[model samples]
Target: MSMRVPGGGFDSTNPIRLDFPQSLAVYDDYAAAQKAVDFLSDNVFPVEQLVIVGTDLKRIERITGRLTTGRVALGGVLSGAWLGLLIGLVLSLFTTAEQSSLAIIVGTLLFGAVFGMIFALVGYAMTRGQRDFSSVTSVVATKYEVLVEHKVAAQARELLAGLPGGLPDPFA
Candidate 1:
């Protein structure tokens, strides 16, 4: 769906611009691609005409650690305690000066710890030893390409050529 920006130039309705876009430059990393665009913007070039597209996508997953019953219970306890402390603080805001907010916070913390431990233990047991490892996954791109409307591709290339090592080597 097309999002109406302040200026009606970008047609976000389509992933790729239907009005032919030509590659202005390609960089190994996104930062370099972004830098090129920023440079163009600083030079008063039509930034709206440019788009950075990531290609050669890859999904990487890093195994953090093996999960154990004790570890799970400890993690749950810590998270629950934090949540309980937040709730207690919010609730205590409505209490009168005669009521001790400390008592409420401490009571909630204890209850949270117990509830957390029980839930953690039960969840771990239900897992049946499946998915016992923790991991983080990310989708990354190998290359980032700067695309500009075909009409302004030449101007973009010329502007980019002024930047240090901005142009990709044709020999390599």
Candidate 2:
């Protein structure tokens, strides 16, 4: 089944299906593919008929640093303090002048810091050094492909040919 948009065109129910798509161009990066589409839009091409697909995906992990109890505790303290500060501020808004807003804020902050440190230490201890390092992971694509509906492929090609260095060598 196909879903209809306001303009009466069938909105693609499935993103993966290309609907008899033809490759307009392929680039090593997503930005280049986006730029090509933007150029098409500027030239009054039907941008809705285009799709950018990322292919050859790879997961990359970068080791940031070694994990330690002290670091964990510090992180916990900072995060907890921020949360406490936000809570305290909200509470302060509802409090009267006689309620001493400053005390409440400080009290919550101190409590949060202690709580955060304890939680962090407990979590670290539970891990038992099984995971000792911290790292950031990202999934990236090696290539981006510009796809157009088959009917408009020739027009897209003709327009892209006017762009300098926009079209890659088909034979290559």
lDDT (10s digit) by residue, model 1, range 26-132: 88899999999999999888888888999999999999999998899998898778878888888889889999999988888878887888888888889899989
Segments in model 1 whose C-alpha atoms lie over 4 Å from true places: 1-8, 11-19, 169-172
* Model 2 steric clash pairs: none
The lDDT for every candidate, in the order shown, is 0.84, 0.84
- TM-score, candidate 1, is 0.82
**Model 2 C-alpha lDDT per residue in residues 58-92, reported as the tens digit of each score:** 99999999999889999899988988888888888
lDDT of 2 at 169: 67
TM-score per candidate, chains pooled:
0.82, 0.86
